[model samples]
Target: MDTKKPYLAIILIQSIYAGMFLLSKAAFDGGMNSFVFVFYRQAAATIFLVPLALFVEWKSLPPLSFVTFCKVFLLSLFGITLSLDINGVALVYTSATLGAATTNCLPVITFFLALLLGMEALRLKTSAGIAKLTGILTCMAGVLTLAFFKGPHFKLFCLHHSHTADTAAASSSLTWVKGCFLMLTSVTFWALWLVLQGPVLKSYPSKLLFTALQCFLTSFQSFGIAIALVRDPYEWRLGWNVRLVAVAYCGVVVTGVTYYLQSWVIEKKGPVFLAMSTPLNLVFTMLCSAFLLCEFTSLGSVVGGLLLIIGLYSVLWGKTKEQRLLNEKCVSTGVNKQGTELTVVTT
Candidate 1:
């Protein structure tokens, strides 16, 4: 696997997520129920991924075990249900700026979790460790810049529905403390899920099938939640509206494509690597908002984004360098080298 490919995948995924944020904000403004939207998104993702899984992993499909299904179910619950569904609820109660700032916590959360689980080492004395830490913190700073600073409106192109999201922002219902806690809950579980998925993917090793299974499971789970909250069947009705469009876009692009990409990245790079890529979405959001929504491109946002890129690259370079050194050591010591990690010590 080319080292650059995962980075490209993550960057592209981040850009898509940033654009999705704007589009979904518009849909939310148009009075779409978050729960219903989640159900639709999951349903759509299942529809898209199932076929791919069937065709690609058809021959190599691992036999389904109860334990594997259970792991996949837990993944669906945490990754989709808590991360996204609860995240939507948190966004409603919080300001976008606040949400953005806290959402940057994912990398930090995953970093600590991975370290504690022995999946990552904190060799603070090493240059690689220092670079990784710096990059993680730099990404967070970039998020802060995005959250707090909106410079003069220098954007040339603007979306037609930008005003809708603007109106939604204006009419936001903010409960700062409550929103912060809820946002924390969402990101914490999301980060947790990312870390846990590594082991699960190792055991499964069927990326598409696993992703599709998670989406398929989430579709049902979200539907049940929707039924509990929205007793009215009519509320769940789909129409040719922004809500429908948002669901379709989220289902196909956000869930279907990004899930597979994320799984592959996690399987290859580990959780911290995946977490590091998340803050890039904030950078994407700033640029997308400026260009597509005619929002001002703040100097702070630009500087922060540049810093974030530098930091992210620094981390990637550090990890790559560290991996190379580790592999060389393993080979020299007559230990087993399994790509990014040691398979066994033959001493």
Candidate 2:
């Protein structure tokens, strides 16, 4: 019922993503296999979600049909398995900075997919529409700047024995082009999940149940991948270590909570809103790393972060404006006319 609720969700989601970067990095530093880590993450998420879904959404759960089950399976495959797998591989071949830049394009991909699938409208004729589209581009530009350009060093709390100049150099394998392509592929899979889940959630309508099922299916899917890649039992062993901590944090906070929040947001605000929220992850990451890791930012980061915030707000205003116009139209028409016979958005 609130037009502003998605913003709150976006804030929380981005914070979680930022924290994920730090925690995932620690997990990797501790020599955790990415595949095994993913499997454990989904497995733990499933364990947590099962009881919650069973109890919380039990009454609301719809009968799972064959077609719906297939859809959910595809969702799990793309959303969890394929996207994370490709992302990990991409990181191996490319720098983490490049990977973040690649992910920054989520708004662009999600917006276009939403328009193509008729889930979101391209009201280019209106200022609000143009602002929304341009904002996505602007946000991408900001991220690109932050990723590629480091003007001058700037820091708020980074004085502990470290080189400031080399901060942009995120550790990665040097297969640049291959890594970029893989990263793009992962982004595509992620966007596919974002676009398709809106429709699936409409049909199924049980956020908790579907999310839990997706986690369960993803756990198995990840396990299969892990089996093919990881033969060492030591990698899979979750003892008292940072690897265990990462799994717990990622599973409970990132996947379990973040996925459910995103689903609920898509159901409420549409995928465009969810997609447009990605830039904030960079903002949060910048702040988190600066304080936590004593990492310093550059002039490019300062400029780009400002642009990112502006673009994000512009997009939000555009989307909200469209809703207002649609509401007005509905009131004038005295019927649910589906925004002038266009089902591109539903309130």
Clashes of each: 0, 0
Q: Give the TM-score of candidate 2.
A: 0.76
Residues 103-189 of candidate 1 have per-residue lDDT tens digits of 556665566678789988867799989887886777666655544544542444665545533543444223534555676678878
In candidate 2, stretches whose alpha carbon ends up further than 4 angstroms from where it belongs are: 1-14, 89-105, 150-187, 257-280, 294-307, 335-347
Worst 10 residues of 1 by lDDT: 168-177
The estimated TM-scores of all candidates read 0.73, 0.76
Summing lDDT over every window of 10 consecutive residues in candidate 2, give the lowest-scoring window: 164-173
- Pick the lDDT winner: 2
Per-residue lDDT of candidate 2, residues 1-347 (tens digit): 38778889889988888777656654664578888888998898999999988998777779888998999998889876989888876654443334445566665566667878888887899998998888788876775665555667666675454432243345332354466567767887898897899779988988778888998999999999999999999888888987888789988998777877887898898866776677677767766666655555667656766666667667777888998899998798865564656665543
Q: List pairs with backbone clashes in candidate 1.
A: none
RMSD for each of the candidates: 6.1, 6.4
Residue 346 in candidate 1, Cα distance off native in Å:
23
lDDT of each: 0.70, 0.74
Q: Which pairs of residues collide in model 2?
A: none
